[model samples]
Target: MTTQANVDTRISEPDAAQISEFLRDHPDFFDTHQDLLAELRLPHSSGKAVSLIERQVQVLREQNETLKSRLLELVNVARENDRLSGRMHQMTLDLLAASSLVGMLDALEDHLRNEFKADVIALHLPGLSETQLHESGAENLVVNETLKELLPTPLCEGKPQCGRLKQQQLDFLFKDQAAAIESTAVIPIGHHGQGGLLAIGSREVNRFNPCMGTLFLSHLGELLSRMLQKHTAG
Candidate 1:
């Protein structure tokens, strides 16, 4: 028994000579076996370590894919937001460009044509009454054929004249023949007695709704009416 005990101890412990010889023969053997030696030395009660590691790797891969999808969605949404913001900025710039009555009308027509896509735009101003005109000079005011038909006979009996019959009350009309006209907004221009009207037509029915306030168009109309009054007076 004593001999057997001595033999077991000799097998378990490396002699100094044997250790030196092994190290000289394979210098990297210890490095290569370091992790394996450590794992072998640990208690087996730690459970299925390989299975746990594989499950962790799978969970990490799934999380990475989810994160990648979320990042892509964010990028797409940001691009769309930038596009819409740019369009809104351009519209604001166009609205600010209106200065004179003719310019305002041109701008409005352009907006309707380009943005709202209207079919036709028309403007009408009532004729002067017979009593206001000098009988001798009245014949000159009745030349406008369409105006002659629309106005009362008394207003156009003598000369063809552009008549201002009332305070800031200008009649405007817009017709969309294609039934493609989706929406219309009649904005009265000017303050008190100085303004005319702005009629906007759109090809989309829901484009204009009663819920929308008249602030922007009303201000534009007032500016235009003031310019028109100045032009007429001058």
Candidate 2:
């Protein structure tokens, strides 16, 4: 037979998980044993012992601060989205007001350079010949088979290709400006990209990261496709 003292010594102390489970099971345990809050001490970040209640208050304060920071971030994102929408609305009005293909191209170039912060812009449409486009006043906006090849790839589907492009891809799109462009947004224009493509180059590397959302690009592609049809038909 084991001695009573030996049996008491063998009793396992509850682990942190066990204590957490017990508290979860009996939320009202504190109601009955409120005095434990004063007796129990916890190690704080400042390397000092604090009563359980004080530690809990500190934890709650930290959590409250984290929540506040997250809320502010969400607010800032919402404001940015609102600003982008307003700019898109203005661009649409400008596109509608354009009288000809050259007018549309000039309007797009102006908006991208001045308002949208784009460093260089290139457009490639399949139906129109290079000579015709150049005569219409579009320089470096070539009509090429590259647009057809790119549309079938994952990079140019509904999602579009963003961020740093490969050496060959950059050379084909940007030409002389390829080395200067740190990042690019390649929007597939027209149905299944049959109409062509639009490339917006930026000097900043992070301007078009792969992880960024492409919903805006998809909308832009659709808008450009429709606008091109209106002009190219005439």
Give Cα-based local distance difference scores for all models: 0.48, 0.80
Relative to the unseen true structure, what is the C-alpha lDDT of residue 102 in candidate 1, on a scale of 0 to 100?
53
Model 1 regions lying over 4 Å from their true place: 1-104, 115-120, 126-172, 175-180, 192-194
Per-residue lDDT of candidate 1, residues 1-234 (tens digit)? 479889899889989999899979997875877764444432223554444335546679999999999999999878966764565355446545655435545665676566545544443322323532232111112224564354322224321112222221123143323243445555444432123334455555565666654444555455545544653453
| Predicted model with the maximum TM-score | 2
Model 2 lDDT, full chain set? 0.80
Candidate 2's C-alpha runs over 4 A off are: 1-15, 136-156
RMSD of 2: 3.2
Per-residue CA lDDT of model 2 for 95-193, tens digit only, reads 889988888878888888887899989887666767657855433433346644643342345457888888788888878889999999988776555
TM values, all candidates: 0.35, 0.87
